[model samples]
Target chain A: MTLGRLNHVGVATPSIEKSIPIYRDLLGATKIHEAFDLPAQGVRVCFVDTPNSQIELIEPLGETSPILKFLEKNPLGGQHHVCFEVPDIHAAKAEMEAKGAKVLGEPRIGAHGTPVIFVHPKDMGGVLVELMEAPKREH
Target chain B: MTLGRLNHVGVATPSIEKSIPIYRDLLGATKIHEAFDLPAQGVRVCFVDTPNSQIELIEPLGETSPILKFLEKNPLGGQHHVCFEVPDIHAAKAEMEAKGAKVLGEPRIGAHGTPVIFVHPKDMGGVLVELMEAPKREH
Candidate 1:
């Protein structure tokens, strides 16, 4: 059970700028990473780090983006996933699959280039979850 | 900046037994705590601990509970709140208020007799976050 610490909670919002102040000012988080046009995921993201865990705010880049659909249904926004830091994302995925849980994302590059995967919400009783192996910290 | 770590992520579900196997076997979580008929909150809760963070499954006791309303709005269950392990919940609440965040619970006793306060989602950009303070052993 050499799991790492939980890295972050991913949130899907319509705009990052609108969400930043709540995290930075209210939660005492600071902007640590930012990226845009993730063509693969069809969203732009910004990561804010508090003393405890990171907060990832994502905004859809196009009308066709899955995030756009999510926002349409949940205009007020909803949590995307509660991510847990794991030692080996690949191994975790394998173990989860063996237990009959549906795995969504395979071990793959995620925000900030960390290896990550998702356990289906249905399997977890309706909470989307992500497992990530910490990537190299960047300044 | 010694803030607390994320203690757990709460989720409102329709059933706890159905959700256990996924969390325990698939997500590698172990059942650490269980509380039933919390009249104060009108829900039954089960705490599942992973190596890094805990997962709380909440089941509404009746249709009168607020969680029941949340489920009615979004049939698909979702993440509820990010619970942070703080050192002084009062200090955390005062700081949050000073920074213009609305306090929900206002430093009250929570699930495990820990002093806790909830920052309103309206103040957190759609993320319901709880600040908890009380010395407790890590699982």
Candidate 2:
């Protein structure tokens, strides 16, 4: 599977509204998407784009959320994942699993109607990585 | 100061040799440089390069090394820093510091003679970031 580009960097924080301004002023990113109450994911996320890459700010909605638990000790912040744009998510997952890498989730529909798969950190030397195939734009 | 491109992603590991094959096979990167004794920093490092970016695998040299201490609890793997290429390292540091980001180090020589400085995670939402400027090439 061909890796296209570095898609985005994921960061887990305490609050998006508080963090957005800092990132915007420093990185010059514009907020492209914002959503709340993603109960299944247990967090609210805002997608901000810069010229070269995108930044994902995730804030936990409930106490039980993994990100919430992560923040208990590291209240300052945490690196979530480094996503890579792949031409084919399924093909990439298959290749990774074949090479003794564990696939965290099977390819499924993710935000923005794109097919994405998460690879476990255990397989990738402790860095959680995501492989995504962008959605086709309809005319 | 404008961010040029991402230079390298630093990954702290227990053993650079153990982790090299995985990155090589998965990311299509080839070994470019290896330093077994960084007495100044108390660690060993191997640089792997891909077409667009590089990955730095660092392992502590002795028990007293900070990386060795860090690996004790986070043995699975984790990011050390995400460095961005800049035209001027000191200028970038000054700009980031003026914006309230804590500069970890003054611009100094790092791998390949590149002048670099680190920004503390406190200001970057827990992600250790480095600013780097290219070295002059000799004939």
Candidate 3:
């Protein structure tokens, strides 16, 4: 259960459209991906690719979206959770729990279409950490 | 000024010592570096290496440390900033200002001893972004 590559850093944003130029023009990021909605996750997500790892821009999709609370606290949005790849999702979850870290919920399919589980921020140095099974191929 | 590698994600902590175990034992991170103080930045920093990038654990070095204000707002501490490498610091700064992004201050030597500048989070999709001159050789 060694630490793996950082998959991406999730950033909760109020508007993905407005945020695109910041990455594209300001940062000279040319590989900006299109924004899409994940109804089950209750968020619209976009990926801005860096040479290594990515920045995931997420916006609320519905009234009950979890990002709504974070937005309430930070009207302008902010850095959300960081996702890391793991060899096995179930093994990672068991290791986390055994180490006395709180797993947010049972392993479930994440936006990357792989099983993932989130570890509680309070138990993970105040950083919400998402552990996802490594994708079968480059995404 | 094209986007380079995702260098590291900075995590502010009240105590770097307390945060080490979280990355080490809990996440099975083996390449945790020794902590050191950067009096100029007023933060004690440590690096935890992952396959792709690194996680920087920062603890306030003194009462006047800038991180103190952030810690006051987020008592448990949290993700502070994300650093990206650039081929040229001056070019990146000019490009950002030209794009209407507010660069926090003139480029200065950062903890990594490289010229770096920070963009205002308000203008960066609510993410504090640090742009550093790519190191001459990997640290």
Candidate 4:
């Protein structure tokens, strides 16, 4: 239940390439990180850095990708979930479970290379919530 | 379309009273400000301050409230929209217009008593985005 920061907002896009101009030209956003394909997650992702947090643009990797299903419903894509940082993944998972929340699965490595898990939207006020362990601070 | 900072994530709830326990007991969230009503907006809102930003719990104030439509589709409530701060509302509006983004209406006073406007979601990757004029720093 302890949260550190809002790392990013997961945005589902039909095509990350096509969506770039909207954020760049219309929003005046620069410094977009290179897009990457995360096979384990069945999606391609690009991080658009904002001053305080990031907008994670995600695209389906294949026809069978879950993101494809989401896109089928929305067509144009939409907000998928919000990711927040927690100091400890295991503890956060346990805390959420203790309060009767439904965690989708065990903690798995996410796009940021940090352990992450998603809480079911039904148990989270109809909003799919992602909790990720913050990258360890370099001393 | 320049942005200042993330002000808060707007969450639509059927009842803020029922939703409080979820955030407070489950999410370990504290520092919930007193709930207030915005007659013009026709919604009651409460700001739950988080480590970095805030979660805005909004409930329709009356049958004519606009939030009613959102709640009708999502009875249990859900993440509504995300708000970002803008240094200058007028300039940001012009910038978004220059690139063909649809601004919902003229600048109006938002919950925080600052000028704000909503960008049509169709142009924003299916996300309803709010742009608020940032509060000037006290020198």
Residue B134, candidate 3: C-alpha displacement in angstroms? 0.4
The list of candidate 2 runs beyond 4 A from truth reads: A2-4, A27-40, A48-51, A62-64, A134-139, B26-39, B49-51, B62-64, B134-139
DockQ for every model, please.
0.44, 0.36, 0.85, 0.64
Which has the better TM-score: candidate 3, or candidate 4? Answer: 3
lDDT of 4 at A21: 83
Worst 10 residues of 2 chain A by lDDT: A27-36
| Second chain TM-score, each model | 0.86, 0.84, 0.95, 0.94
* DockQ score, prediction 2: 0.36
Clashing residue pairs, backbone N/CA/C < 3 A, model 2: none
Best by TM-score: 3
Which tens-of-lDDT digit does each residue in A47-122 have in candidate 2?
7664456667788987778687778877977778777776677788888888888888678765545788888888
Tens digits of per-residue lDDT for model 1, B4-36: 566778888777766666665565554456646
Q: What TM-score against the true fold does each predicted structure earn?
A: 0.83, 0.82, 0.97, 0.95
Candidate 2: docking tier: acceptable
Residues A1-139, candidate 1, lDDT per residue (tens digit)?
3435667788888888888766665665544566566767677888877655677788888777867877887676768887777777778888778878788856877776778888887776777778887675679
Candidate 4 Cα deviation (angstroms), residue A31: 2.1
Candidates sorted on DockQ, descending: 3, 4, 1, 2
Estimate the TM-score for candidate 2.
0.82
| Candidate order (TM-score) | 3, 4, 1, 2
Instruction: Report candidate 3's interface RMSD in Å.
Output: 0.8
- Candidate 3: list runs displaced more than 4 Å: none
Better of 1 and 2 by TM-score: 1
CAPRI tier of model 1: acceptable
Best by lDDT: 3
Candidate 4, residues A67-130, lDDT tens digits: the string is 8887987787788888888889999999999889999989999999999999998887877888
